[model samples]
Target: MKPAVLSGVHFITGDVACAEGALAAGCRFFGAYPITPATEIAEHIAGRLPEVGGTFIQMEDEIAAIASILGASSAGVKSMTATSGPGFSLMMENIGLAACTEIPCVIVDVQRAGPSTGLPTQGAQGDMMQARWGSHGDYKIIALSPISPQEIFYQTILAFNLSETYRVPVLIMTDEIIGHLSERVVIPDESEIKLVSRPRAKGRKDRFLPFEPGPNGVAPMAIAGEGYNIHVTGLTHNEKGYPDMTVECQKQMMARLTGKIQNNLDDIIKTEGYMLDDAEIIIISYGVSARTCHTAVDEARSQGIKAGLFRLITVWPFPEDQICRLAERAKALITVEINLGQIHLEVERCVKDKVPTYLVGHVGGTIITPERVIETIKEAT
Candidate 1:
């Protein structure tokens, strides 16, 4: 059967549409502190949640905001939180806790100029690395970066699905430019979207092991106070979810935590390519910078330059294989971002010195222009 038509679609800011996407994905619990660019996400959800009989809490700070989302998720509710750079940093500890405890939740980071609140309301793509490893630990995280309001809507849903499927926090690494810019977004119907809930343990409900592995590597999550004596903590624990201090237990637990993401990377990774086949140079980017890069690629092609474009929809996991393949064919790899070359390093790492990579970046409130990217491509050519 064909999917049902989704009509009356219109564009809006990525932040506004992301909130709606969370609602459509059945997010009933929102705990967020207001921050620039991303504040509208919380504001939109705060208004929408009440109409759906859900709970929306403006916590004291980003720390408490993330903690509340974890608490809500443990109670078997689909929950999420949104923030900008500094708030994202504040939530890092609890985000690591969410990683350790395997809590399924979505974190929307509408990135802005950073490194100590550089520009609160302004745009920047400075937090790409932070989104991957900001939390203090040797753990893997799933991060998605959308290029448009339409993608923000769909990626928000994907974030929740991935979180639930793997029982780990998923970050929607949005940028301020896309977050604040309004565009037409066609909201898909609920029935058409594939929503996956965490598997619930059966039988021995009274003795359910919340950390026990299931078929999908995700353990069955029994809600707190749901008549299941489930134990949850941030410590390294055995299958019972208690703190374990032994070396073997710690290794195994860490393995499970990180392995869930690494083992299923193919399902969690997403990217977009344009004219990559037989192209000489491939410009890689994400967020709003990709918009500029796309135009640059077009102009370069018009100028008889064989330039391709690769946009990362899933930022984490880094699209290493795709990058390696494209890098082998291209003379140079140019990474375009709205900050001081965060993801450019990843591109370099993937190519492993096999390709020369150039960083095209900006700071403060400046947006990287298409002309600048075109010039960079011409120089490489």
Candidate 2:
């Protein structure tokens, strides 16, 4: 099988760049439902998947779309799906299954304003918390946010890599603005790109402990058709993957499911700090909200506010250590996003009143301007 490489520089939307990134990341299966702001990703990848020995399926709804990719990943293929808010909510049940079963798949959520389909084409950062805790029960997740088309392309590939390496579903938490924004993007040659494949189950098939935690706390997976005794179920299971409905069994299962991500925080978390070396006030933001923050920081500097930007390239796993340490020396923290205060809540929780934390956000629809961010920075000061 060949990997698709859309090499070189070209002007493209974030949606198209995401598709190319998935292809380049060795994602050979694309299963998705049509939803505005995110539909372009499916539309673009559908035409391209076939050209590189990949499969593209249009599922009836978000639930089926996610299930299809889960099945595809179990069959030893890199798989992914994209959806907006409502569809994202629809997939929560299955996303829990993916977490428990330890399936490797990428889920791109191109968010719009919504509790229930508020805006199809408009952008919002409301689902940051949902992407982390939408599903029932507790299982760790890795989520990435990109500020622009070029970064979205990179983040998508990184999402797949993280998913494969950790054998868990990774979320690409982008908003409609980044999804639809057209800009210059560069797709490097296949040789220049780095990709990660899941660790295939090794040793004798008969004695293989499918759910046994390895050194990294992640079990080596046995692909379905490869013939190892693979019992992939959401039920609390042992190393042998048999259903065990007892407290002891549930405890062990939860440890494996959540431990792998918790142990590798350094590897899974990514963030970019700008002008933070000596900054007194920090602007914490992610996705589209982080876009104008660069200008806001610059403008804050021009006015001598000593403000800096903390860009959450990776949102999930919370980066609490970094936030806490930054808060220790900083005078204030301003969380910026389209939502009223989803991520801001997390920021506040991390700071624990060490420094003042404020939110500069709205319900949704429009992008937050640099001037607004600067205003918030001023208020925080």
Please tell me which predicted candidate would have the highest lDDT against the true structure.
Answer: 2
lDDT of each: 0.87, 0.91
Q: Candidate 2 lDDT, tens digit per residue, 1-381?
A: 444887889899999999999988989899989999899999999999998999999999999999999999999999999999999999999999999999999999999999897988899988988999999999988999999999988988899989989999999999899999999999988898898888889999999999887889888889988889688788888889999999999888888888899889999888999999999999999988887888899999999899999989989988999999998999999998899899889899999998998899998999989999888788888
Q: Which residue runs does candidate 2 get wrong by more than 4 Å?
A: 1-3
lDDT for residue 338 in candidate 2, whole number 0-100? 93
lDDT, candidate 1, 93-167, per-residue tens:
998999998989999999889789788888888888888888887887899999999999889889998899998
Per TM-score, the best of the predicted structures is 2
TM-score result, candidate 1: 0.96
Q: Give all TM-scores, in the order shown.
A: 0.96, 0.98
Q: On a 0 to 100 scale, what is the lDDT of residue 369 in model 1?
A: 93
Show model 1 residue runs off by greater than 4 Å. 1-7
